[model samples]
Target: MLRGLIASGRLLANRATTQPARLSRNLVTAAGPTSRCSLPHTHHHHPVAAVPALARGMKVRSSVKTMCDGCAVVKRKGRVYVICSKNAKHKQRQG
Candidate 1:
């Protein structure tokens, strides 16, 4: 039983070392800018009010079409506006 346990432990240690090298290589290639699999940079500018709503446990709605129960509303510069939902004056700004 002791021999079996020692063999298993050695096998596990060898396997762990080999796996990390393979994973690290893949990560380096994928993260490189020249790699075809690399994702495009996306700049998302969130409204100023999103910070307070996130702290208060409100989930950000994905679409403007969804009706919010007054939770996602924000007041900025004397104007009350819905952060996620589309208003009558302006189209919904896609993040």
Candidate 2:
């Protein structure tokens, strides 16, 4: 019984030491900032440039809509409309 316990304890100690080394090696190989922001490969690409704002000349006004407080007059669908700055749909599109 004593010999079996001693052997098992030694085996457990060996397993514990080996596990940490293996885990550390795996962690070292796997851990880092991944290429999350990489753009997909594509053909027929145009040079990237910042687009000037469509509503650059528009004036801001208090919102009359139910969704938000601040609003801006912008042309959409060949007609001008009041777009609320604090709208939930606008927040999601921005993100």
Off by over 4 Å in 2: 32-95
lDDT of 1 by residue, 15-88 (tens): 99999999878877777846555557788887676544332223333543335443255556754445543333
Full-model lDDT, candidate 2: 0.57
- What's model 1's lDDT at 84? 44
Q: Pairing residues by index, what is the TM-score of model 2?
A: 0.31
Show the lowest summed lDDT stretch of 10 residues, model 2.
Answer: 86-95
- Summarize candidate 2's per-residue lDDT along 1-95 as a digit string, tens digits: 99999999999999999999997666666664453334467778789899886643333334323345565555556554566666534321110
Task: Give lDDT per model, in order.
Answer: 0.57, 0.57
Candidate 1, superposed: residue stretches over 4 Å from native:
33-95
Per-prediction TM-score:
0.31, 0.31
